[model samples]
Target chain A: MNQLLFFAGLKEAAGTENVNMDLAGLTVEEVKKKVFEVYPSEQLQTSMVAVNEEFAGQEHKIEEGDTIAFLPPVSGG
Target chain B: MNGKQVWVTEEPLSPGEIISRVTRRDAGAINTFIGTVREFTKGKKTLYLHYEAYPAMAEKKLQQIADEIEKQWPGTTTVMAHRTGRLDITDIAVVIAVSTPHRDASYAASRYAIERIKEIVPIWKKEHWEDGEEWIGNQKETKPGVPTKEESR
Candidate 1:
């Protein structure tokens, strides 16, 4: 299982801050697909993902116990 | 023994505390900038400001800003602390302090740090006005005499 965290605007849009995905050896894209399946109305198209605190693209593979974060573009000063 | 020191907190920030952190015997010039919550905007009375951030990314971006300053000005000490959560009027929102042997370097680095922070850091501020609260984000194209919603449209 992997722990996923969402922050800022993404959290507000998703309506939940964090979730645990029980998909071992799945790619990041697969995880994102699961998220979309769970929240079909969510605006996941514009969000970005991070793995282990580093910005990651969709192709990045996820291992067991990995920490994933979904982030929306932030506007802060 | 060198490089930049950074601290990010949800507690209210104090300019005096930040100043004490970077002060050293070798530094001759220390420049600090404090961002505060204002009382009025567009004729609306503000109640408070709420700040939020992507903790990991914010900390990383702050470190990069400090590294850039160090490269531009050698032997410079920089400290930047931004507050999160709710803040009332007159509360310190952000504090940036830079120390250098000369005033020019201190001023330059301090200015650069604040500008870059506003540009790249993932922190958002929501202004709570008497009537309502509005989130201010991506002011990249803000212009005079243009209403925010009209501009978006």
Candidate 2:
């Protein structure tokens, strides 16, 4: 099982901070699709996905026990 | 070597402390950039601002920015801090300190750090106005490197 984390507005839209999904061997794009199915939102489309604290491209392969995060465009100074 | 060079904290950010971390004996110049909350933005009266972040990832990205600065401008030391939770008007929101052998590199690196934070760090701010509140950059039209709707207005 992989833990999917949400931050910023995505967290508010998802209604939770994180979720566990069985997502081994799936690509980051596929993970996004599966996650949206559970908590559908357009914000997820614009978010940048990260795997294990590093930004991941859509084709990046997911491994078991990986931690995934969805980050919206930042507004920090 | 305090190991607090890049951090996200709920407590108020101290510019003096952040500047001290980057101070080096060989550095002839140090540039500090402090971002503060204001009462008015885009003609709206902001009551306060609430900031949130993916703490672990935010710190990682901040360190990445510092690394990029050090690479781009060799011999430069950089430190950054961002305050989370609620911030009132005139309160410090973020601080970036850069020290280099010369003034030019120090200024450039400090500017680069702040811009990269907005571009890549996993921090977000929600503006509370008298009429309403919204998360900045959360709109579909608001993308990095593009002027946000509020900004364009």
Candidate 3:
């Protein structure tokens, strides 16, 4: 199982901080589609994906036990 | 050391404490940038702000920013602190301190730190207004003058 995390407005839209899924072998882009199907948001399109706390591109592969995060446009000072 | 001078805390941020972290005997100048919550934004009266972050990743990113500054301006030390949780109007939200052997480098590096933070840090702020609350930079946000999700609820 892989853990997916959300933050900022994405958290509010997803209604939770994290979710677990069996996502091994899936590409980051595929995982994003699954997420949008579950919790649809336009923000997901612009958000960056991070795997295991490091930035990952859409084609990056996901493995078991990986932790993925969806980050929206940051507004921190 | 990784992340020794970077922090993401729930407690109120203090510029003084952050500045002290970057102080050096060989440094001739120190530049500090303090970010405060404003009472109004885009003509809306803000009640308060709620900040959140992916703590582990945020600290990593902040340290990366500091490393970038050092590479760009050698002989510089940088410290940054960002406060999370609820913040009232005028409350200090973030502080960045950079010290270098010269004033020009200190000023430029300090500015670079803040800009990099906004770009890469895994931190965010939700603005609470009298009429509604919206996560700043949420692309799907309700347009101004329209009823917001919170307002309609």
Best by TM-score: 2
Ranking by lDDT: 2, 3, 1
Q: 1 or 2, which is superior by lDDT?
A: 2
* Reference interface contacts recovered per candidate: 0.35, 0.61, 0.59
Q: How good is model 3 by TM-score?
A: 0.90
Compose the digit string of candidate 3's lDDT tens values, residues B1-153.
233689899987777777878888999999999999999777889999999999999999898888888899999999999999999999999999999999999889988888777777788899998788988763334232212223221
Per-residue CA lDDT of candidate 2, range B1-153, in tens?
357779999988878878889888999999999999989887889999999988998898898888888889999998899999999999999999899999999878988887677777789999998888888973334453323323211
Location of the lowest summed lDDT over 10 successive residues in candidate 3 chain B = B144-153
Minimum summed lDDT over a 10-residue window in model 1 chain B is located at B144-153
A-chain TM-score of every model = 0.84, 0.97, 0.96
Candidate 3: where are CA atoms >4 Å away? B1-3, B138-153
Per-model TM-score on C-alpha atoms: 0.78, 0.91, 0.90
How displaced is residue B123 in candidate 1, in Å?
A: 2.5
| Candidates sorted by TM-score, best first | 2, 3, 1
Q: Compared to the true structure, candidate 2 yields what TM-score?
A: 0.91
Select the stronger candidate by DockQ from 1 and 2.
Answer: 2
Ranking by DockQ: 2, 3, 1
Fraction of the native A-B contacts that model 1 recovers: 0.35
